[model samples]
Target: MEMSSKLLEKAVSEMAHLPGIGRRTALRLVLHLLRQPQGQTESLADALLEFRTQIRQCKECHNISDAACCEICSSPKRDRSMVCVVEDIRDVMAIENTGHYRGLYHVLGGKISPMEGMGPHDLTIGSLVSKVKEGEIRELIFALSATMEGDTTNFYIYRQLEGLPVKLSTIARGIPVGDELEYADEVTLGRSIVQRIPFEGSLKG
Candidate 1:
């Protein structure tokens, strides 16, 4: 069946490519955007373009930033001695939204999954090891998910950093297995921060 205008169809098609958006929702959103002022449309386009043109990865932590280094990495108030290791940029935002953490972060960019052709070499694992070894950091917290892939990645990093100067720890167990950090409630995430445990073999309790 023939649909609406080519422009409307185009917008919906593009939106449908996003993670959770479907054709029906995308069409509704396109219609909603169509009713907005032309300036609003222009602003959206500009913002989309600017996302890449303006933002870049932080050299130190590998997080997204408008500058070479993210504000978190440059902030003196942030605990340079503490570094939270996460799988992706989204996890960084999830943790930052809680406002319960005061340390810096190191985004691995992805988990270690041989099935998907992602391995330790593909992530920032080496950088993390080097960072912990420099003696500038003290704690390395694994805040990735509880899924199999998340566990694999965590184990990979933990083993490599076992002999480093920093303390290796994992978030508390209340998160429940198979849960993604992005979907975790802030209260649970905050509580986990307080009760994180030392990584296996880190030190005798």
Candidate 2:
């Protein structure tokens, strides 16, 4: 799309790079921003700048936070013995919305996708294994998606802690095959967490 102003064009180009946003949508957004109060636009820019510069990953779970540790990780009410392993903060948010899980979480950053060149070593799997080795975590729940890559990552972690005393379980099949945990409705996701099965049992099928 042709724009009269290079500033608007640049803004639209950057916005278009965001996922699910097209050039048209980005242009519309940029125009809307221009029409808004100058202070409002400045505030938006300031917030984004602060977020980009100040955001931190939770040291324990690797979830995004403003401080070294996320609120969930530092919460006193959370179940320290149960840790749900998820693909990322988005999955963590999805599971948290259900309110069914009261345990801690371990964000894997991403699944093991050989096609994408994502391996176990590329993720925070080492810290997770070390967490289990500490003997503080009693159950490690695999809350990753049901896709091949997700399953592969789960199995890989399982093998790592096979001899450890921690119990390994996976969310139930309430989530359909190849479905992402983030897209599932709250009811189904909550039920899956409530009715998780042993990791070994999942391997049989």
Candidate 3:
């Protein structure tokens, strides 16, 4: 349905394209923005533009950052010896929110999904392997989703690390099967981290 007002229609359509937003909700948001002081809306637009252009992946951990390395990677306070492997930046945020981890992270970028045609080559697994082999790393924590692809990815990484000096562990399965790490609450996520278990699976690959 084409909206009669061109500017309003454009705003609503763009908002609709964003995740979890519908045309009606977008219209409401636009109206709210319009009602605010000009400074508010203008600053918001500028900030959005800045975020789009300024953010990049961290060189070491692949987390989102405004510089070459994210705060986590550069921070001396974080524990580099314990590296946590996550599927994406959202998982990093979720874990950080829990305040349960002081270690570094390696973003796989995505999981190994054969049906979706995503594979190990498409991820940063090779970089993770290289990072682990660099030594001084004590534990490699797998904090991916509990989905089938997530399991496949975990098993694959586990096999790759066999006989390596690093110990392989995983966040507890308290996170429901099919649930993403990004959605788990801080308490649950914290508990899971505190109760992580070692990988007992035999790597087929």
Q: Which predicted model would earn the best lDDT? A: 2
Expressed as tens digits, the lDDT of each residue in 57-137 for candidate 1 is 999999999999999999989988899999889999999998889999999999988899998999999988888888998
lDDT by residue (tens digit), candidate 3, 53-147: 99998999999999999999999999989999999999999999988799999999999998989999999999999988999799999999878
Candidate 1, number of clashes? 0
C-alpha lDDT of candidate 1 relative to the true structure: 0.87
Q: Sort all candidates by lDDT, best to worst.
A: 2, 3, 1
Best by TM-score: 2
Candidate 3 lDDT (Cα, 0 to 1): 0.89
Instruction: Kindly indicate the candidate among 2 and 3 with the higher TM-score.
Output: 2
lDDT of 2 by residue, 80-158 (tens): 9999999999999999998889999999999999999999899999999999999999999999887899989999999
Over 4 Å off, model 2: 175-205
Model 2: lowest-lDDT 10 consecutive positions: 196-205
Model 3, which residues run further than 4 Å from truth? 175-205
| lDDT, each prediction | 0.87, 0.92, 0.89
- How well does each candidate superpose onto the true structure, as a TM-score? 0.80, 0.84, 0.81
